[model samples]
Target: MEVSKNAYYLVNDVLRAAKLYKLPSLAQLCRERLFSASPSSLFGGGVEALAGLEEIAEQDEKFSDKNSEDDPHKQVEIPGGSARTLNDDMKFALSDEVWADTVLIAEGHRIPVHRCMLVARSEYFRAVLAFRRSSTHLTTEAQVSNAMAVVNVEDSYAGIVRVLRFIYYDQVVLPSLNRKDAKGDSDGVEQEAERAEGAVNDYLAEEASDQLLEDLVAADKYRLERMKRLCEHAICVTVANCLEVLAVAELVHAAHLKQVAMRFVQTHLAQITAREEEFRRFQKDFPPLLEELYASLRDASREEFLLRIVH
Candidate 1:
């Protein structure tokens, strides 16, 4: 159970060799053992803390022996492939030409994506792709995988990829989305000449702080509740993004995030007020929030004055 790193890779190396040496049967056995012994360490964490379930209802012994030898394949209509937890398979799936089904154009980069994944996770995409049922809708220049869909997006490639990661894994690895957020900037967005473009790391933007606001917008538009909460958690109080958070939260209709942003503004009111540019931006864009801040301060002052008089 507590295998050292050296032992771990040594087993993996043997398994690889077995397969290469025309011994898949040996490789398969070793692979199963490797999977059972601390799968999290092997997969780089985020696997369930443990595997298998005992409390799961046992099938009545009456139904345990249901295999048929007369016919080999059951339900041939179902898509056949190795049973995979693609949630952890990004590097392979994103890179493998065969798996990608959609093209996401972002920040001058054309990102290849899986259509099945987008449809399953995003309601916006479901509608977008469903509408393009007619073959006449696809554009000539469109680069499509599985002849599925194409989408254009204005956000940074990094930001959009973060969103895609969320959709593929939920909160476990990434949280995906649904619907209007699916059909953004509808021009050249999807293959109609396309269906369209695409949550995230621990509010994980590998680069700019603005990723929070971008994620919030995508979450709100795509109706991703968990992603919204994650963004809210990442939208911390800081001088740089304080006002930006408030404005963007309002624009995205994030009432709770708006309240949180407002509280930060109020707590830092003295400092925020001293900054004329920030204060004017808030005054112009969020007049109501500015008024609420003033009103709260006045009430606090009045209460303090009353306490002094009583003393």
Candidate 2:
């Protein structure tokens, strides 16, 4: 279908404004078009114009891809492949290399790629450093806030680092089993020790407790499972002694806690019964939250929570 002239003019006007204003991404244009523009007013530039714009964008992307092939900045040569388009694997590898450089720039660190061999001996530590170093590349407050929220919610240094790397570099670091020569027993032990050392270093290098909490919240929103698990584990392990964390944990893991609430009530019956006032206060304050949590869990799973009162 053809776009009407009036609609085309409006779309062009918006696009021109967007280009002139130097917005970092097309998201703002999309938001303005979808939310601010009236449906009737946008009729001329409606579906057809939008489709045409998308087609143009795709063509531009292809043209850029073609130009990149001849771009001097990307002058890597492949054997017997002068005419062929770059494969996905090659593109991914190049992207990773570029992201690694970007991470260094963001982190305010200056370790050259060659020197990275020794510095990156510990993958986990390297990932953490990259996260702290590259967060600046996010460039927008919303992006920064979202990333921070993910990190806070996940509550694991490793998990937070992984998400940050994905956000900043579009790469996921997967764990793999490494096979070493069975004969090199001493070297294997030394390597293992180094790994342990790196883990300790990362733990020590982590941000403050408050910052970690914020990161855990962010991680949960971003659906970084590993980070979420780590955060939960950390709360149960390291911060369990803290009453504030214990309360927050109850709110966060309410459904899981409810599943085992009977057991918990029985085990801590003395504490609950003895501190009736406190328990009553907690129930009153978090009743809706607890109910919502239980309802969600019951809906997802076929388990209902039954409570009994004993006089």
Candidate 3:
């Protein structure tokens, strides 16, 4: 299908979900489609657009002063008439052991982070930092030049840690619940324990799904756009958990995830809410969604019945 604006935004999410599922073919398709589109697709495709912009700058009469050393106007004008500059990844390579300019206290757990990186990464953080500038947030031990600021983040310790990790590393590996120490490998000294390992794997899968839902909420709260998409994509693929995921999406105002979940429920209501126990779980957690899905299923069945009667 031709890539539309909606598809353009979903490219990264699709690629991330594909990678998580080990679908190299799908990942390649996403990459190809992304590159096929104009370089302006996502933040100017980061680096690919740089070369083209440089060429444009060189050809322009505006940048004709080659002999001049300091041409302050030696800038490339992009489509929006804004000067093209690098994305500014904002690397923090401070040498001091306690060189952080911001201390975030999430659930009373303090974490040191660079002010510049936080401001550069998130609009919410930028505002928070800006507000802290004139406030009494700086601690005595913190270097005055650094202008340290402390802010309390209201979230679970684990959830806050995951958000901060995503901010700093651009990724957060979810906690692994697959490893079960209860059973060890075999050597005739111990029976293989295949059943135990399979159960453990299943547990891990569920754990990962639940963690993604949680990460989605935290990402939304902090305005981590890409991370939010990644979490949503992870949860969206699991139709079985769509009810709970949908709940989280609605709470976080995740438009894409909410759409994906609603579509999943509408298209595969019976298959998704199959088992009585499973349906009850969804009913308990998200009664309104379960009711909506049931109504849709009933309406669809009615239509099918009416069609058969007419035929």
Candidate 4:
């Protein structure tokens, strides 16, 4: 079905829902319309419209180093405690309840937050915290007081915290793998160290991978594009999380992440397919994704076969 004129502005929203509901034709139509739209219109115009300009700037020498010396961005200097100090101060404020004007409740955790910070950082939160004026001419103190104080979020506490941390400091901090001492005698010290290292690696490979998956989903849900990119890069480096990452990338429409995950899957197809449980899980939980992977594999094989025939 085609997108109606009344719903033209909601094509992106319809696309996401169509994908979720497995409506390929609707999704494809929405994608065609969305892709046809100019980047400025797609991204709400202004600075956001210039999102990919840096890539063009890098390739065009006229826009590059020759003019860097006179660039206003390069001329500015941090006079005081450095940008890190400012970030740290903001992070500290995330936990400081005294100055907080709002609260975000997630997974039974009550997180104090500032309305100004929320308004500045997220469009979702801005709408949530926006005051409703009863009349066009006037808004009373009581109407202003109707602004959100406690917002209940459906995301996990960790996910909410991670998103808030990114909002506060513009950083994605993954959970660190801690080194635990393996039980052993002094004579077995070398072996113990190796065991400890291996154990830590295994635990992090599983646990950290899961955490990154959750964080990426949260980042996408909150429209934190930069955080999602950071998560995508971090997720790409892991073999253990590739499948789940692929699933998430597709679900969230993270094109870069999906491409990277597809490459990872292609390279590790043998190893991944060997795991019957995981293969079965993919078939059950993500049938469409599994079908696409097989189709991709077949297409790759056909191209390779044709190239060999020519050679």
Residue-level lDDT of model 1, residues 130-237, one tens digit each, is 666444455554633347467887777877777777776664223232223344366665443233331223233322456667787887666667787888776655
Q: Which candidate number would show the highest TM-score if scored against the true structure?
A: 4
Cα lDDT tens digits, model 2, 58-141, are 754565575566553433444475322324343444335442432222233232122143133334434554575475677875
lDDT of 3 by residue, 1-311 (tens): 23554576577567655545545556678878867877555335567566644544354323235313344443323446542222222223322226677788877777777887788778788888777665655566344445657888888888876776777668755656647555556654245576667677777777788788888887877889989887876663465576777778778988888778777777876787676687677678877766766676688779989999999
Better of 1 and 4 by TM-score: 4
Off by over 4 Å in 4: 1-84, 131-148, 180-196, 237-239
- Would you give me the overall lDDT of model 2? 0.45
The 10-residue segment with the lowest total lDDT in model 3: 83-92
Candidate 1 residue spans exceeding 4 A from truth? 1-86, 134-146, 171-208, 296-311
Whole-model lDDT per candidate: 0.63, 0.45, 0.68, 0.74
- In terms of TM-score, how similar is model 4 to the real structure? 0.65
Better of 2 and 4 by lDDT: 4
- State, as a TM-score between 0 and 1, how close model 1 is to the true structure: 0.55
Error of 4 at 191 (Å): 4.4
Q: In what order do the candidates fall by TM-score, top score first?
A: 4, 1, 3, 2
> What TM-score would each prediction reach against the true structure?
0.55, 0.25, 0.54, 0.65
